[model samples]
Target: MIIPAIDLIKGEVVRLHQGKFNLKRKYLYEPLFYIQKCLKEGAKKIHIVDLDGAKNPNKKQINLLKEISKYQIPSIQIGGGIRSQKDIDLIFDLIPNAQIILGSSIIKDFKNVQKWFNLYNPHSIILALDIKFNKNYEKIIFINGWQNKSNMIFEDIIEKFLNIGLKYVLCTDISRDGTFLGPNINLYTEIVKKYPEIFFQASGGISTLQDILNLKNSGVKNIIIGRAFLEKKFTIKEANLCWQKE
Candidate 1:
């Protein structure tokens, strides 16, 4: 599946190159308008990130979500600032039917994640792994929209989460996220190979259809495209049409 991203900051649709918080660009279309364009273009799922909340817990992006949720677009999956049960509760209160994604929160407190997993249906939860491939080639999951580094290794973290009964994970290579360069195919391949049972949604650095093809070849079942899809490097219609070709 292809999930188009809607990054929010003070109610604007922004894109960050390489997942860097400082490198953001505002889109011409409004948040809801952009989401509608993507949905009409053939996207079955939408990905939304609360940028302000990701950077500062004091901020929220509920307005953008409320606007998008007004439409009966396909499934909407959201992440960012989901640290506490209150935050989760607030999200459910606003967009109750939307899928909830945990970013740095789940990594910081696995117990809370476990509790949510036990309490809610697995389909409603997604663990977002914002990762960085270090100079030594060690893969580690980054947090706070790739600003902070986590001690957890990618594979080990996946193993731990999978063992805890969490089935869905959105893995984004911080080094390539929002770059529109290309995805970390080898890293995705390795992870998918190790945990084939986990429902992995690959994100970051998808620039071309070949990148999508390579992801499919690597065993990835779903992917998130932010910069590329919005920039017209490719269109959602093209992406959906190409899925069958793969």
Candidate 2:
């Protein structure tokens, strides 16, 4: 599954190098451009992150959600600034057909995560496992867009979501996110091997057609691309071939 990214800031798809707030690069494509491209590329879903809301909690998320709702994409997994139940409600209200991704909020308050899931159920929820490698190079979950550490074990969080009837997970290697270097396959491969029960969506630094092939052969359920697609490192047509091979 090839899931294209639409990282939004003030209502446009922008790529952030290494997830750095100051290093944002806006794409020439309008939000609609990415939607049409991903759909034509045989993408069943699209990953849209609200960057502005993630950095500044007070920032509004309606415009981004509105734009997504207008698109005819099958499923849209959206995240960033999704802290309160009200925030989740607002998103669902705008895009009732969308699947919401809860990131930092899950780490900070699992109960709140549960509350939303309890109300909305599996179809509406997905946990985004945003990870940053520590000094030891061991992957550690980060919240608030890599600003704080959750110090949680990888499967521990995955298991929690799984037990609560949430079956989808969108994991990212923040260290590799938007770098266009390469994905952290060793890390993803291990997760897919260990947890065959949950659906895994791999994100971060998937720069080439080969990288997509590697992920598919390794059993990754889905792949999310950012910098590589923005930088023209690979074309959507090429990415569709990788997914077709799977």
Top candidate on TM-score is 1
How close to the true structure is residue 38 of candidate 1, measured as C-alpha lDDT? 92
- Candidate 1, 114-174: lDDT as tens digits: 8888787777898888777778887888888678888887777776767667788888887
CA deviation > 4 Å runs, candidate 1: none
Candidate 2 per-residue lDDT, tens place, 1-246, comes to 788888888887898877787887888878878788878867787888888778767895676678668777788888888888888888888777778888888888888788777788686787888887777866688888667778786667877777678778888888788887788888888988888887889998888898998888778888988778767787777898867876
**Model 2 lDDT on a 0 to 1 scale:** 0.81
* True lDDT of residue 28, candidate 2: 83
- What C-alpha lDDT does candidate 1 achieve relative to the native structure? 0.82
For candidate 1, the 10 contiguous residues with the lowest summed lDDT are 60-69
What TM-score would candidate 1 get against the native? 0.95
User: What TM-score against the true fold does each predicted structure earn?
Assistant: 0.95, 0.92
Prediction 2 TM-score vs. true:
0.92
Task: Name the best candidate (by lDDT).
Answer: 1
